[model samples]
Target: MRKSSSLINIKEVLLSTRKVLNENAIIDSDLESDLLVAFALKITRAQLHANINSPISISEQKTIQNLVNRRIGHEPLAYILGVREFFGNLFRVNESVLIPRQETECLVESIINYLRHKSIESPKVLDVGCGSGVIGASILKYFPNIDLISIDISPNAAQIAYENILKITNNNNFHVLVGDLIESIKVQVDLIVANLPYIPTKRIPTLQKEIFLYEPKTALDGGTKGVEIISRLIEQSTKILKPDGAIFLEIDPDQKYILKNKIQHLFPKHKIKVLHDLSGQERVLSITIL
Candidate 1:
């Protein structure tokens, strides 16, 4: 015997929602389906499917329609689902920060590999401009002993990062600061990792609406050349990092050559390496203090 439900049909809603999403150019129909249903149920995607046939309550139906309308209007999937996966971990996210991109995971891997080769004493890590704490949290997850400090300029992003921290480790080893990159931290660090905004101000407006309109500009604007934050961080990092410490960052492919030249000019003896991403794009730019 089935219960008579006031709620709309689950399968019907998913079919209609999938069509709506595809119309908006969302190619991953499966992900779109899961996200909408998850939002409607106020449950994890896994849970949503686990009880797929279960009749939805009336209130859930209302919530589903509202969320689907928002998603159809071009809101990001991360913003709709309220989560993002990065570096093999799930982190809370919202419109407050730039969604974690797979490209940045290469930056984290480079640091891990470099540490393995150098056999350095467990290094203390600092992740400046850590939007969702993904970079810092991933580092912590891999090397639990690495002391970490992460910061974001937006308080909302910082709050999201803090929530993520609470979900991960219990040790107070990780510090989440809210402000410009290095201004809030007092302790010296052994490794500096940042994926700061590198999109030039002039180009931001030309980007797709999902980025230009939905995402916060503070996390995207990089001034005239998209090097403003990186340049400042490089100068300040030199003073705080241990002479033997290293720094790694995710950079736009076109900007790598200029950054490499700048590092060579300012610190002639130090060595710099431009790592390439999966697509062979120049991605993680690493600097070793000699």
Candidate 2:
């Protein structure tokens, strides 16, 4: 990169980034600007805005240019930062695990409310396919009395999850295992939550560049129908969940019609509800054993 071209000022770089991000992009250009700028300067949002005109240094300029270029190409900001916020806590993220989405927090909130008011003896949680341990850790944050067990098929994912959950919680008596769902798990629990891979294989390539390019395909590619994992999960969940326990799954809305029916058939006596995200698309399915 030429010093002359690279010598473009911070203000100019922000303008260039904004221009490259088309109007139809999911994230607004302004938000992308803030994220890229803050990331490049290694400063907080407030600090970035406060020092926007402070004359970005040589390395800072190079870093800012590259990140902004990537952003303009539709890369996800979380991938660039290598961290994501979930349930009000920061967790390390990469292609190894699914980036925590806001919709999952709704599921977490529901569980927290249940444990907060209801009286139960030693509430236990099983986070099936616990990538990065994000969901389990969030629940652990509030319900310390609860025993938590998280399992993942990938050893790499298990390692990251273990490191993240080791000393972050008080009781810290949780279990992390590397194996397939339920079969590898031994204990019965009050609740089982999963943010399993639900995106249909054919639909993955059409996703935004950030998601398709940066995030791992295994964490997003739901089999041909998108519910292959969920189907297996529901079948095993009945055997693993306590008699009165429940299971929560994050899913794509388009699959609900069939998913709801399958849930009904899989656990005929259970109460099932299909939840919708902010966009009114059904995304979570919760079933409680009767």
Assess candidate 2 and give its TM-score to the true structure: 0.87
lDDT of 2 by residue, 196-251 (tens): 88888899999977788878788888899998988888788767788888888888
- Model 1: lDDT of residue 130: 84
Tens-digit lDDT string for candidate 1 (104-195) = 88998998888777655667788888888888887787777777788888888888877787676555677788888887667778889999
Each prediction's TM-score versus the true structure: 0.91, 0.87
Clashing pairs in 1: none
lDDT of 2 at 179: 84
Candidate number with greatest TM-score:
1
Clashes of each: 0, 0
TM-score of model 1 vs. true structure: 0.91
